[model samples]
Target: MAGFIEKKALKKFSPGEIICLEGDAGNSMFIIKSGQVEVYNTVDRREIRLAKLGPGEIFGEMSLIDGRPRSATVRAITDVECVEITRAMFDKILAGSPNWLGVFMNVLVERLRIADKKQRVTDSVEIGKKTVYLISLMLEKEEKTTGIIYKQSWKKLVEDISFLLDIPPSQVSGILSKLIFTPLAESEFNYKDGKTFIVKDWERFLKFTRFCKERYLKNITKGIIEEFEVKSEKEVKFLKFINEILKEQARANDIEMEYMNSKCSEILNEDISKYEKVISELVKSGILKKAVRDDGGKYILVDLELFDIKFQKYVDIELFENILKKFEN
Candidate 1:
């Protein structure tokens, strides 16, 4: 069976060699014409055996179908001879046998089903981002409806948030419905396009999340990696926002440099510099300005207005200001 493979396609593997690992791009299928290969998965730092394959058995057949990750690790158990069928060959075979289209579809569908399990985790995070984004949009719509900001329709709002969050319109709608239930709920509008839920009191949501963030700021900083678990981008942005507020509050209170650091540590239960660095970068970028305190504080005075301008580019101004107020005490 191994000899059935074209000489050009026949590949050999040495014992103990890793033929492939999980999450690698699938490109080729292998038919073990000789020798043996072991399959395993790593979980909790332990190797769990899947199975072993010997002569005439095929591995990577699924890879040929879906072009997804290998899903498991395979290592050569002994010097081996295997026939490889690449994605190109798989397509060529399909072209010649359109009658097998249903077979290919079934294989691809099964691969997708397995892949969806991995995607559920990804989708949950995506849904979380969508939740944040929809809330942000709801704030804008509320501000406009109340004449605080420019007016925009719910359809347009959904479209904009969907594009920014990189999620489907349907997912955005589902999340928006949940968001509308809170004091954050503004107005509900149904149009030919779709339904939109707006936030009525932006301040309520802002203050609530801000209070939540501040009350948990200590725990948030300590267990942040576990709680309110945010992505690196959001974490960085949030840290920067908090740091700028701390700097401003320090300056306004005329707190000494040593005192501000101590105060920050007390409030967030963490050193201030982690956030200080982020503010320093913004200052360097001219997005934020810095001033020195005559009180002889080692920390730089971060300009809140400058910080607000920069942050407004990434998040809502009202939301930013509310989140920053958490550090005021």
Candidate 2:
């Protein structure tokens, strides 16, 4: 069946090309002949994958069946070849077919619709990001009337988010309860107004969302088979030296690159010119962020708390998973 269909007007898409965008007007559906594509949608400014389609798979039929805007976006993962069957073309083909064939097609569309609906039941962390975004908007709205540092009542938060995201109030409250476990939340978030939730620094809470999503999406990204759970003895020693440097120095978060160059000589007890490789890897490992000094030299922006956890504790997948697991309503 697929071989016969491939003879139709075929469309070729290269990798990373968008075949269709979510919520766009889509008049046709795609039947994959070869390569791979991913169906995804953006939520909280992040793309959440819905499905992966390979040869002989179909997508975008929902738009044709219901005549609504496309529900999800599709992008080519590899060099892709697909036959785009328009709604009118499909109707014409089905018109010449047996009555049972149209029924079979309808059955396929209904099942796929249900599967896509299930995909939209996003995880709790995604909801947390959405919640933070909503709070930030509310803070801006209420900033003039509030005192220093914006905060919201738990009751208002639950009510608004439940209405905005169309989620139950209980689920929103569950996510908020776990939000306090985050690092920024530990210091800034406090129980007040008779157990009402309050976030002190609006910006810090915003970064918290990105921090969690960065780690969450890291697991979902494909072709990156490496894990930073364990390190070689040499790498561990280097991280220990950096940690000790941070500990001895009172203002250690902004250690200059030139300082690391000096430390390289001291630690190895030889004139090693610079130690750029491991520190660069630390940035990739999410243990450090790069910053710049006034003199135009680079520095490692160390989150002392996260540094201890990921570097000293040698964080494993299960540890971070447990943190996010708490937010799963």
Best of the candidates, lDDT: 2
TM-score of each: 0.33, 0.38
**Winner by TM-score:** 2
Local accuracy of candidate 2 as per-residue lDDT tens digits, 1-329: 45656676689999999999898997999989899999887765667676899998998887876677998899999999999988888888888989998778777878877875654444555776677667667756765324545556777888898889876787777777776665434223354554455666565555444445555566587322234334555566677777778877974776776677688777776443344576677778777788887888877777777677666343333344555656554
Could you tell me the C-alpha RMSD of candidate 2 in Å? 16.2
For each candidate, the alpha-carbon lDDT, in order, equals 0.60, 0.70
RMSD (Å) per prediction: 17.3, 16.2
Give me the displacement of residue 31 in model 1, in angstroms. Answer: 0.3
- For model 2, name the residue pairs that clash: none
lDDT of 1 by residue, 4-121 (tens): 4557678899999998887798899888888999998775455657799999898876665766678788999999988888887777767777777857676776967678565655
What lDDT is obtained when candidate 2 is compared to the true structure?
A: 0.70
**Residue 68 Cα positional deviation in candidate 2, in Å, after optimal superposition:** 2.5
